[model samples]
Target: MPYQWPTLTNWLEQIAQPFYQQGYVILEQAIPADLCWALYQDVQHQQLTAAGVGRQGQHQLNQQVRRDHTAWLNQNNPVQQQYLQQMAQLQQDMNRRCFLGLIDFEAHYARYQQGDFYQKHLDAFVGRSNRVLSTVCYLNTLEQGGELLIYNEQDQLISRVQPNAGTLVIFESCRFPHEVLPATTTRYSIAGWFRQNSSIQGRIDPPQ
Candidate 1:
């Protein structure tokens, strides 16, 4: 049987309400299980490069900050297209309900091997970037380690998320600082951002 992705209407309330009250929301089994499995398989076959910090001119591989491999999601692949489509629906709903004015979303498959970790960081800074919302969709479960730690603006720990297949997390990009703790086993997930168009000087900003 083919996997039928759930429409945003089915889960929008769960996402929108918390996001409205706080700055983030986390949901389990957010995507179809079969779809998550397919995406996991797709990533296994991809050629991933060591991920870097910063963007464009400032981008550089800094293992001290992060240690992971990543491959940008390609819309050409059917499995990836399905996932992207789901995110597209999310983007639309976010704009409609939250007035985020999100114009686009970009994502990449991320793999964290044993002992890999990402240092605490913010996805975007006010007035410095277009990213408005940050997202993470887990494709595989882990027994231990590989927890995502989210912090409040005051630098207090708030949420500790254990990687679980089909879990999705969304948060305001500039309001939260988060990090991936060292993985005891391999971890697979998709990290993404919703952005508003920040075109300037007659040139469109490039996607990362």
Candidate 2:
């Protein structure tokens, strides 16, 4: 069967409620198990390139900061399209319930090799990008390590998330400072962001 998630309204009642109460929300089995494995297989066959930090011209490879290969999601691909469709519905529900005014969604397949890790950082800074919410959908289970740690605005550790397959993690882009711990083994996931159309200070939302 094709990928399908819970109804938008029902899903929000359950998923978004916790999201607002806490700084983040985790949805187990958000994506079908078969779909998760398929996505993992897709990444295995994809020609992933070194992921860079920042956007466009400022984007540069900083392996020391983040060591992962990535491939941007595109609608041309069936699997990616299906995954995106699910998120599109999520964006609509988010807007209706939370009034986020989300305009678009972008995602990419991220694969972290053994010993890879991403330093603590914020996904979006205020008045910088349109990234309102950040999300990660784990495609494969991490054997050991490769945990995600999110910190509060005060820089205090808030929650630790294990890389469990078919789990979706959602959090505010600017509010939470998160990092991926060292990957004792390879890890596969889809990382994405929900964007708004409006920009601040006459600047583009994001140059990506």
Candidate 3:
């Protein structure tokens, strides 16, 4: 017998209530172990570049703020496609259950080497961005370090998440301020955002 992966329905059912009540949710073993393993393998061969802060023209490297390498996820790779498909299903579910009006999702593979960290930051600002929900899926486990710290509106810590394989974290992009703590060992994860189309005057507000 082969290992059975959880269905999209299962994930949808698990996500709704907690997310509605708290604006965020963390799920352990959210993805299939085999799929995570495959993605991790794919990441090893990717040409990762130093991640930047801010968007488009404002984007620039700032090692003081973050020190991770990243590569955007695309459909051409079968492994990445599988993960994207899962996220697509999640986007539909979020729209139906929460009326989020999500139009699409974008993601990237992030690699955090030892001592790498990302300072606290919000994924989006109200009325300034189209990103509605942010998601993080861990592809590799870490015994220590690389914990994700999520803060509430009062700037108080609410959750400390360990970077465990197959764990998924989803939160309202503009409501939470979060950061990645330095890792004692290498860490791997996928960070993604669900967006609502905010086109104006026949132009994409934020070009993909």
Most TM-score-accurate candidate:
3
Per-residue lDDT of model 2, residues 120-165, tens digit only? 9999988777888999999878768899999999999988999988
lDDT tens string, model 3, 110-163?
999999999999999898888899999998889999999999999999999999
TM-score, candidate number 1: 0.94
What TM-score, computed on C-alpha atoms, does each candidate reach? 0.94, 0.91, 0.94
Give the Å error, residue 121, model 3.
0.4
lDDT (Cα atoms) of all candidates against the true structure: 0.91, 0.86, 0.91
Question: Which residue pairs show backbone clashes in model 3?
Answer: none
Q: On a 0 to 100 scale, what is the lDDT of residue 119 in model 2? A: 96
Q: Model 1: per-residue lDDT, tens digit, 162-188?
A: 999889999999999999999999999
Model 1 off-target regions past 4 Å? 1-9, 201-203
- Backbone clashes counted, model 3: 0
